[model samples]
Target: MKFSKAEIDAVIAASPRTNLPLSKLVLSEERQVRPQGSTPKLSVAELAASIKDSGVLQNLIVVKGARGLYEVCAGGRRLEALTVLAQADDIPENYPVPVLIVPTDKALIASLAENVFHIPMHPADEYAAFARLIGAGKSVEDVAAAFGVTPLVVKRRMKLAAVSPRLMAQFREGQIGLDCLMVLASCDDHVRQEQVWNGMPSWNRRPAYLGQLLTQGEIESDTDPVARYVTLKAYEKAGGTLRRDLFSDDDKKAYLLDTALLESLATAKLQKKAQQIAAQGWKWVEVRARYVFEEFVKFGELRKTRRAPSGEEAAAIASLQSRLETLRARMDALQDHEGDDDNDDREFLKLDAEGEPLEAQLKALQESLCVWPPELMTQAGCVVFVGSKGTAEVKCGLVRPDDRNGVAEVARKASEVDGDGESLVSLPSAKTRPVHSEKLTRRLTAHRVAAVQAELTVRPDVALVALTAQLAHSIFRDDARGYHRPETVFAITAADCQSDLPTAAEDLQARILDVVTEAVDANAASPLAALKKADAANGAEQTVAATGWLPACLRTRREAGMATEETLQDAPERAASEALAA
Candidate 1:
């Protein structure tokens, strides 16, 4: 049978009123005892304040007990707050606490209903509330205290509230996840936030991607080598600002915004470090943002041999060890009580910080005992750079090719006569070649080729054979350098082989500066300045086709060879020949 609307309403209200009428009764611990369950903890401070300001807003459900007492089956949190006020004498002992009297059997159902149906306010409401509180001139700390949450939490709410209203609405509608809202709220610009949202493809709207999108052009302070070298405070002092991630603990998400400032700071620090190294009597020092390990392999590193520590040094080390042991014992003992007391933890950390520098100093002193000879040090210098580990690294006693003084022949002579160190006397050599100075090499080769051409007429058979061989090679082989101009050739006789090519410049001048230096200083045409650097980039660049002027292959078969002017300068005799004669 169909029922009228009024009849339906009557049927609904006909049942016993579960929401009973509220009445005030004497407050007592013996009566209306609070129930227990695994429930979310209430903020007693906040609740207590509310109760003090306005007496209980909700009626506590109670059950009758023996001796005119009542047991609280529901609204335990309200009872707890009321109890706190009563204990503090803010409320009278027999304070009239408003409650709803119910039967004992139905108390469990009432308690479960009260707890299970209680839904927390949406996060959007929380954000709005926090925003309203802030707009009303309440500080972050004040709002935090009122809400019983951290200042960071209150700030986060305010930030979320500040995001684009559209995005916030989407978040409220459950269209946006917490992570999405959090990352989107990184920037204060609502317009930018909306732009990022619109620009982002639906498939890649992940939190990490959104965070990176928001923080583009910003360098993570912790990961930046410059920031690691210079503290964040120092960067600020040098005029840099950091954007901190509120969601991150301990401000670990700091990002350095002023890149130019960071670079300047890094350069200044590197220059200072370089000056300090140069003060150590190094001939030169270089400063670079990064030093590659590959470059170190190109240079010859002097082997370091340790000298025995003196009595004073040994005693100092022993004393430091004793102190370290004592400190370590104390630290271990303190570690047992760590976090028990703040002061104890501070002391433990302080000792820990102190121990590291001392240990480092000891290690450095021990390392210092090992020495490269002062002579070697004077001949060579070092390079200073910020390594990947965010510390200054000094590579010492690396001798440049130009720094090599004695000739191999002189060293060989000295070793034969007696096992003394290599004599510093210069000897003639043709090993060094001018790969970079192509024009200079061509000129030198031209002179030698002219001489060879004039001499070829007397040695007709050798000339004919050499011309035939050159033709065969030129026709058969695909040499990129083209046919070596026969006019520049310096022919060699099989009976008397020429060990040294005549076209080379002085032994030192023939040595090409590192092509790295050549490319870098190429415009300057001052290879001498870059002679100090042994760069791996130069080695890689040098791996090009071995193209150079060779006079032997460039000589021509000429008829009338003798020149009008025939004068020659006498060459110096070999030192070994002179020594044998004596």
Candidate 2:
């Protein structure tokens, strides 16, 4: 490759620097107007907000225009932002805007050089810098303010920074995706992260699946039954840990890391309830953290009758009910607690204390109202268990099949006749399925998807290409070839790789392409290799072999992309050429 003397002359043209009022700077007429799906320009409002947050950190390149005015050749967004402030009177018309004044003839060169021949900062570097700032005693808010970003943005960077270095390397090498990295960052266990990655076949490593694998045993704090059963306060008191995702729009996006501890706390509460039930002359009381209706199918339940409390007990119950009503009124008046957790907790505790005696007395009276047959009681016992969401439930009068007696059978028959009519076991349905004829589609796709996902995860090399592609496409599509494109697809831009590359050492893209080529070249035993080999139409195509990672679907659409079309008067090069030559 060679550069013309004109380009060298443009390079050598020295640009002088100067400062001017914001109002005096204007957009350059010479600024190249690119079509959509080409170079993307920053919107005025967005640049204005950024400028308002952090004053211009870099200078715009400008050239002398008509009437002694300066036209911005580069940093058009910065110029536009300053113009907006000037229009709104947020800043004085004479407010200083840094500018690098270049020769009028060289203005286009300056703009071209700035827009082209440039690379974006690596995401890893950005994350590390943010982490460093926080590590240096700057609070997240402080760091956000310093960088002109939101606090949540700063936190996201911190999370990204927290990702395992090993995983991040895979990302740089196109082995994993940015979304996957983000999910992995949510879990701090590096060893666990790598293990999950390794366990996943190359086809199934999607961000969602990766998140599932990373957070498998963990529970969502908002939805976990245990979280609801034991108040967050109690769980925290018991040394359970919670992780919150600041990046998430939802305020309740907190996850419980210690599921074991949550179950332990729930068990302890159930154990106390079980102790009280044991005193009721039951043969045995089984306590479990959770209960499933199906597990008790073989255990027959006994019926119990309820009896009214004594006069004195009735009076006490009436008093407790009145107290509870008043408390409930106070709770309603508070209108959703509205950040008053302490008051809510205190009121709940008070209600619990007041209800305890009433509950016990009521239970005793209920037992007196009904009695199981003596013969049935002798053979059967009850199981005490915690229900979903952490409430204690009793399955009383359970008679094991082994303990069933002739008298118990008669009683069971009578109860069945009076019970709600529902089958104890489920039956299979004989309905036809949809046109789709498949099974475990999800599991099967994972193996095909993992490699693609890993390969297209974010990277610094094709960042601009991705950005340009995104902006060039409609707003409805993902920016350029990012996120949505199959990992095996390469949306290569010819405009890239145009640096002062006297050698490949300075060309990052060259080295990366080389790595990809070698890696795919060595994977001769890949799953798709056989399919590509059998494709007579494109089997000899380079793209099919180059993307050994891509499954058949992603590898080709029509003819192989790498196949060369027949061209010359082919001493039979093409069919037409062959006919003509003959």
Candidate 1 ranges beyond 4 A from true positions:
1-35, 42-55, 63-66, 85-96, 100-119, 191-209, 270-272, 288-381, 397-582
TM-score of 2: 0.51
Give the per-residue lDDT of model 1 (tens digit) for 1-582.
344556434433442333322223223333323335333455776787667766778877677666666666667677777777788888876777666665555555555555655799998898988999899999988777655677888999998888899999889898889889988888888998998988989888899888888898998878766678777888888778888888766666588988888877777788887888888776667776667777765554554546688999998888888889989999989887635688888888899998998898789888989876544556567887777777777777665556555323333454456555534333323356434457656655555545445456666654665565555544554344333323222222212112234422332333434432333444433534444334322432343214332333332222233211110010011111122222
Clash total of candidate 2: 10
Count backbone overlaps in model 1: 11
Q: Could you give candidate 2's per-residue lDDT for residues 2-113 as a string of tens digits?
A: 4565774555465566788876777866553322223233345656766776788888888788887888778866766677777888788898988888777666666777
Candidate 2 CA-lDDT value: 0.61
Question: Model 1's lDDT to the true fold?
Answer: 0.62
Worst 10 residues of 1 by lDDT: 565-574
